[model samples]
Target: MATYQIKLARSDTDAARHFTLELDSRMTVLDALFIIQREHDPSLSFRCSCRVGMCGTCAMRINWMPRLACQTRVETLNADAITIEPLAQLPVAKDLIVDLGPFFEKWKRVRPALHPKDKDSKQLAIVPPDSEFGRQAQVKRDCITCGACYSVCGITGSNSEYLGPAAINRAMLRLLDPRDGNVDDRLAVLNDETGVWRCHTQFNCVAACPKGINLTDSIMKMKRSLLFPKKFHDKQAAT
Candidate 1:
């Protein structure tokens, strides 16, 4: 067993609350929070689901880096003291729980769902895995919408209108689809002042994404496509 200090950033208090715990090295930050809430302070609050890191509800700022609490092992951090706080650039609903409203609001703006161009066609639109758009989409499509990228983005911290990383990534996914008919509308949204052009290309979202998605790449592609619509159309036509 190892002894460690857990610091909780409380929204209601000026000083962070501290707790000491004796835990196994393999235990995760989520485990420590469970212990603190169950044994130490029942009032302590946070959000988590699918403890294996899939659901993305466990995302928080751990040791000043945005990450999934369930995926962050105490031993791996190599710090005797662990600082846990709610995600940045969002309203704190409670201890370690931030309102994800802003993240989803932008997500909805990108027209995330697929809109088929040939809805009544009997044949299904097949996307070959080896195709150009398919190859590019495969590498960038694993985002779980954890909001870690949104929280870490500097633009989002300053401008609420900016669509943020996840939304732009989703827009890229939809835009790349060969069958999606909502191109004009989606592109208009992406070209807006608060869209891909707003990204500073800091790569902060890339580093913070637990899924390892290249969010900056998606934003840059959209920017390039906007600047050269003919080139973008030619590439898509060749595929």
Candidate 2:
């Protein structure tokens, strides 16, 4: 049996808990955590649902990087000493669990759903599959709203109201959605205080996104289009 350590951090909790697990290298961080909680201490608490990478519930700060514990391998990390904590820039629910309320709230604030685009026509609202904007929207659909971007966002760390990259990305998706009845309406929401203005072009969220989505670039693109419409227009005019 191989021995591995997990360091736990929580909010308002006076002391940190160190858990030691003895198991094979193939065991994941989530596996080690489950065994430690069930066999070692039932009082301990954490959260997970899909053991697969689909559910975003298992995200935690593993070795200071926000990662899905289920997707991370124990053997791949430092076996002797590994720090496990709730995601940063979020309120801690307990050991290894961060509240997702604020994160998801911002997503809703962006109005991520598609709206009716057809006004008077009987024809279906159609967007060509190969359209450049359509492809960008398709990529944004892959976001799981895991709050990983929030954990590393400098804007999120500084401002409680700042909409993180995930929210911005969601808004971008909606803004690009041709079916939406009010593209300008969505832009109004994205132009608010907790909106696009808060981001400082920090690339941490981009680096931390496990899905490899270039979130920062997307956000900056929004900023440019929103803040300086003339710049974009002028460039278009030049062409």
Candidate 3:
């Protein structure tokens, strides 16, 4: 089996030092990390649940791309040397593990849950595939809340209060949800100076999104929704 080399941006209280590990080709970056932790460095720490990449916990910066380590193959990596580091725009608690408290806090602030117009929401007809919001939400709904977007987001780095793409995208999902109620409340939450206003229209969030969610467009939609509420009118009438 072909062998691969992995370099870690080692865990340090002050963010210094690095470690290296070499592994077999078939193993994934996450797999290699686990082996390294279990055998070589027992103190190494990181978060990973649902190794298939659905949990979003395995997300980390792998050679400049925000990817789920669990889903990335060691052999697939291009460079001879790979730099592994914790997600960006977050406080690194240890090697590869970041404090998720802040990320989730922002998520909650955006009201991630869907509140339908009526509690007795029936099996509504499908939204036309060509509709703007529907097409947009189709992409937005795929978000794993992995913090990948948050990691690469410069706006988040510059402004701690910014809701970030993941949160804004969540709000956009709610906006597209026909059954969703609480538009005013959702808008109010996003209207803060630190809310949608903080995005700065950077595409890093979209580039970093592992799920391919059009975060920039979603953010723009949310911003436009606030900028012009008339755009939110029913599609039938707009047509």
Candidate 4:
């Protein structure tokens, strides 16, 4: 067991607070926060759910990096002191909790749901695992809406209206889905300055994604689809 210092970035209205806790080497950053809340300061604020890293609610800026608190082991940080802050590029509701409304609202603007060609059908079409649609669906469906990608997105930081990586990633998923009939509408939305054009390919979103989704690759795929419509059209016709 070792004692480590934690510096929490409080809200603008409040001064930052520091806490010291002695914890085992194997304890995660979330575990340390829990100890702080349970033992030292019940008033300390943070967000966490499904401490196993599946829910993605525990995401925060740890030591200036956007990451899931539940998955970040303290010892792996290799720092004597740790700093925790709210996710950047969004409104901070409180300590370590940013308003996800903007992030999700962008998602909605991209029309994430599958607009099936035959919605009235009682049985869904089965896509083979080896098929193009199936492979793309498998890769893109892993997003847990963590917003870690949004936090570190360069385009998002510069342009408030830009559809961040997550939204664009969702757009790519719908584009790859054979059942979705709104391809034209979705592509029209993405073919704009705030759409696929805004992405700088910084790769920060890929690094921040906890699920290991290749967000930049997805964004690039969307870019290619928009840039060379004939290629995608030829492939679609072939399929």
Whole-model Cα lDDT of every candidate shown, in order: 0.89, 0.77, 0.77, 0.86
| Candidate 1 TM-score, true structure as reference | 0.93
* Pairs clashing within candidate 2: none
List TM-score per model, in order.
Answer: 0.93, 0.86, 0.86, 0.93
Candidate that would win on lDDT: 1
The order of the candidates by TM-score, greatest first, is 1, 4, 3, 2
Residue ranges of candidate 4 with Cα displaced over 4 Å: 12-16, 230-239
Q: How well does candidate 4 score on lDDT at residue 123? A: 73
Instruction: Show the lowest summed lDDT stretch of 10 residues, model 3.
Output: 230-239
lDDT of 1 at 45: 87
Higher-TM-score candidate of 1 and 3: 1
lDDT of 3 at 125: 47
Off by over 4 Å in 3: 12-22, 121-126, 231-239
Error of 4 at 34 (Å): 1.1
Per-residue alpha-carbon lDDT of model 1 for 1-239, expressed as tens digits?
89999999987775449999999999999999999999988888899999998899999999999999999999999999999989999999998999999999999998999887667868776789997568878888888888999999999989999999999999888887887767777888999999898998899999999999999999999898898656445534643
Off by over 4 Å in 1: 14-16, 230-239
Q: Local error of candidate 4 at 25, Å?
A: 1.3
